[model samples]
Target: MSYRRTTDFLLHDWLEVSSLQSRARFADHNRETFDAVLDMCEKLAAEKFAPFNRLADTEEPWFDGEKVHLPAASHAAAKAYAESGMLAAAQDYELGGMQLPCVVEMAANSFFSKAGIGIGGGGMLTSGNANLLMAHGTPLQQQVFAANEFGGRFSGTMCLSEPQAGSSLSDVVTRAVPDGADFEAEPLGPRYRLRGNKMWISNGEHELTENIIHLVLAKIPGPDGKLVPGTRGISLFIVPKKLVGTDGQLTGERNDVALAGLNHKLGYRGIPNTLLNFGEGKFPVRGSAGAIGYLVGKSGEGLRCMFHMMNEARIAVGLGATMLGYAGYEASLAYAKDRPQGRPMGPSGKDATLPQIPIIRHADVKRMLLAQKSYCEGALALELYCARLVDEAHTGAPDDAAQAALLLEMLTPIAKSWPSEWCLEANSLAIQVHGGYGYTRDFPVEQYWRDNRLNMIHEGTHGIQALDLLGRKVVMDGGKGLQLLASRINATIERALALPDFAEQGNTLAATLAQVGAATKAAWATGNPEEALANATPYLQAFGHLVLGWIWLDVALCAQARAATLDHALLQGKLAACRFFFRHELPRVGAWLQVVTRRDDTCRTMDEAWF
Candidate 1:
């Protein structure tokens, strides 16, 4: 099957993206420069990342009871990416970065993801890690670790999940004690010794860089000499793989971070997912009992500091899933167009003498292809919209920034979970489109599906995100965020109404929006938190569908406005996708909203024994 990059949609339908760059004060990056960056990314990914994608999957990382070893091609691809300077593409020039807008950076990164998500993950983690430090790290910490990370001399990881504490960060038992007296004074500030084991750490241990900067979450004891309970006591720390001195040079002494083992997975096997032991006594640290580290921010504010990286990561995960689904869609579309199969339904025997037509001529195949196109492309719009919101929150006018923040907060959970859910469905349909061959490893769709399955669980599970959306975000600040989002969607609906071709879609979305608002109130009317949130997942689904409906209408309006200027086929494709979503996909919102609006409790009220 022929491969394709979905970034084409960004250029054709999302012309407003350039305005975002201008708003962010990216004066040097006009449309030409932006396209140049994307072109370079496509070339690099096709050459360095794509060739090794299947090899990395087949030869997964392994531990030799001493060190972790990955394919040499993995290192070559990572080095190529780092040397390309894309890792710090969004950072300031003073920080040795390209100073591109966040939206442009995300657009460029999507190319790598389409080539391979596992390789793409390393860059995402490093970029997020560097961005966090740049935001909250002390001056010296930023100069040393963050600089190295941005320069690609070092990579980074976020250690949050422990064997004992997966998502329940409140139960984390990692301990950090002041040990500044033992270590010489350094530019990174006060030091401590971190002791605990971190599980499911991606890029935890590798030779991809000179060193790994670990942003660890642990607790520092109070006067009672006992660690405080829950997230309130947690603090962030910078733990490195090898100790560094005040001169920004390696001390030649390995830190107390050891790899306990490797967790082999079904997909995204390019980078090593590890079980890491910190200060486990398997490795000694200057006669110390734990890993030496420096504080990131104030004590008891670890979760707050970590949120900087987590939020960035959440959106990146959504983009990753979107690209994977898109890759599969492209592959399937190519296959459907080229592979001829059974005759059309009119008359089989009469056409036996005639050439067999491609599967794309069949109505069902078109249905599946259209479904894939809508879901994947709609997801692309949602993620790029979120990225633009990030840019607006940082650099827009004061009122615009405030409004952007509110909308971002309200839609972030949807950004993470909606794409994860629907894009995975796109991958499934892509597999089905390939028939028997798609189920086998010989084709890429199976791998795409396996890789996408992890996105639903990464950053946060679907259920966790659902609770966050329905139980917290929708109600925060007297529902100001939801109101802001509603205003934006309403504006789109109003604009779409002006176009005669989209008046019906606008009406459909407007009705869905009203239903969603009604359901939101109905779901929370009981006043009992448990009773009100019993069906949060369905509410999330309904809310997600509504958001997609709004986004598709917005996209159709954009296409309709450019109908005369854009390619005839491209414009038609966008219009067709918008119609498919409204006609076939948006109606499902009504069913989901009915459950939310009525506060359905079929599962909530069921007895445990019924299972």
Candidate 2:
């Protein structure tokens, strides 16, 4: 099957560092490297990753006695990714990677993950590991560990979750005791031993790599004989799969950590999520009954040090969620156009002799298509926007960048969870578009649904996202974060309001902004935030709906404005999508707003015993 997409599908003509301020006469930045990165991704994805998606799912990674056994195709895909220089795209150039823009990387990452999140896991972990190493590891530490030790043969895992502490890291029972081993330890790295277990670790125990570098989060006893509750008491360490010699190669000496069990998951099955016992039988190879841990930043500043990597991972999570939705939308749209189906609803007026039509011809089907298109496309726009913010955050625009970051922080949960929730719904509707046939195993849609279900549970749950939105982000820096977001969207609407067709949409968006602003004030008015937590989820959804609407309008306005210079008619489909969403979807915001303003007894009125 040929998976051909037109350039019309994408918002921009090609990858470029566009002046966000420049509406006309756009120039592509030094995208030679970016184009090379894109070419590498396209080549590897089509030639290797895409073909192995179904195969990987069919032969889901397995745990034998010692190592996790991934299919040969999966391993080959990983190798291809590494060789193509795409595995470490986010790393610094000196770190042996094709340093590319985060936005461009994200665009390519969409293709890779869409091929299979299962196959994409290894590369994701590699990038994450490289990030951790880059941020926390010292110069000598980088030389011995990142450069020489693991080198290309090593893999990394962010071992944070435990049975008792999933999101609540402060509650982790993982302990790191001081070591008096004969082995020479780094001055900058953690010079102790770790004795604890971490659960839900992806790629925890796999033979695909020569060694695994476990970034264990642990708490050592303080002077008062107790580990603190805050992040200060926590520490990060690089516990290797095998002890390395001065030359940076492994000594073939096994570390204390052992794979307890493999976690069977719904999707991303190619990467093994393992339950690990850090110090088990024959443990503490270099230390006394505890696994040796080379410290990261400071003794107690582990959480602070890890934040750099975690924030990067958060963007990755959002990016993953966005693209999976995009993939489903693209696939479903193609199917609608390609698949021949029933005729028009009209009274067979002109020609009853005519054959059946594609599903795109139907108004209701078009509604579903448009819904998916808008949701996924808005999500793409948001992710790219956030990526641009990240670029600015790194470059010259510090204050604006910081404010942009604050806005992203406020919206991150929504970015991650909204796509997971809304786009999974998109996948469901894709199945519906396929009719009963979609539910069957014959099509990929069912698998797509199964795969998408995990996205809600990944990085963090949807409820967690809602809480993140309402509980913390809303009031951060005296609500300046939210105001910053409002200003950005309002600015877009201001530009769009100049257009003829967008005047009504501009008004609708204005109304939504007002509603959201008011609801935010009401949310703040409650005396106790916990008591007011009932309004959290609805507020999240209400605000999410509005953000999406704003972004969609941005896209429509762009298309309208750019039409004169370019083949504006080519943007007909995107314009239709914007109009369809405004006409069909925007009206529902009022009801959602009612839900927000009323703040009803849905969670109230019912007793706990009723459950």
In terms of TM-score, the best-performing candidate is: 1
TM-score of 1: 0.97
Residue by residue across 1-611, what tens digits does model 1's lDDT show?
12223355554356466665555468767777888888899899999988878888888988777778888888889999999999889888887788787888888898899998877689999989988998999888888888889999989999999998899999889999888664436568668898999999999998889899999999998899898988999999999999987666798999999998889897898889998989887778888679988989788999999999999899999989998999899999999999899886664444667788999998899999999999988898888889988888999899999998889888899999998999999999999999999999888999999989999998999999999998999999999988989999999988988878788998999999898899889988887777778888888898998999888888778777777876777778878999999999988888887777778888789999999
* Residues 171-240 of candidate 2: C-alpha lDDT, one tens digit per residue: 9778887776643455535467788889988888887778788888999887786777766679888888
Displacement of the residue 385 alpha carbon in candidate 2, Å: 1.1
TM of each candidate vs. truth: 0.97, 0.91
lDDT of each: 0.87, 0.73
Model 1 poorest ten-residue lDDT run? 1-10
- Supply candidate 2's per-residue lDDT for 114: 74
For model 1, name the residue pairs that clash.
none
lDDT over C-alpha atoms for residue 423 of model 1: 94
Candidate 1 regions exceeding 4 Å error are: 1-15, 20-24, 180-186, 347-350
Off by over 4 Å in 2: 1-29, 148-151, 181-188, 230-232, 282-284, 348-354, 565-570, 598-605
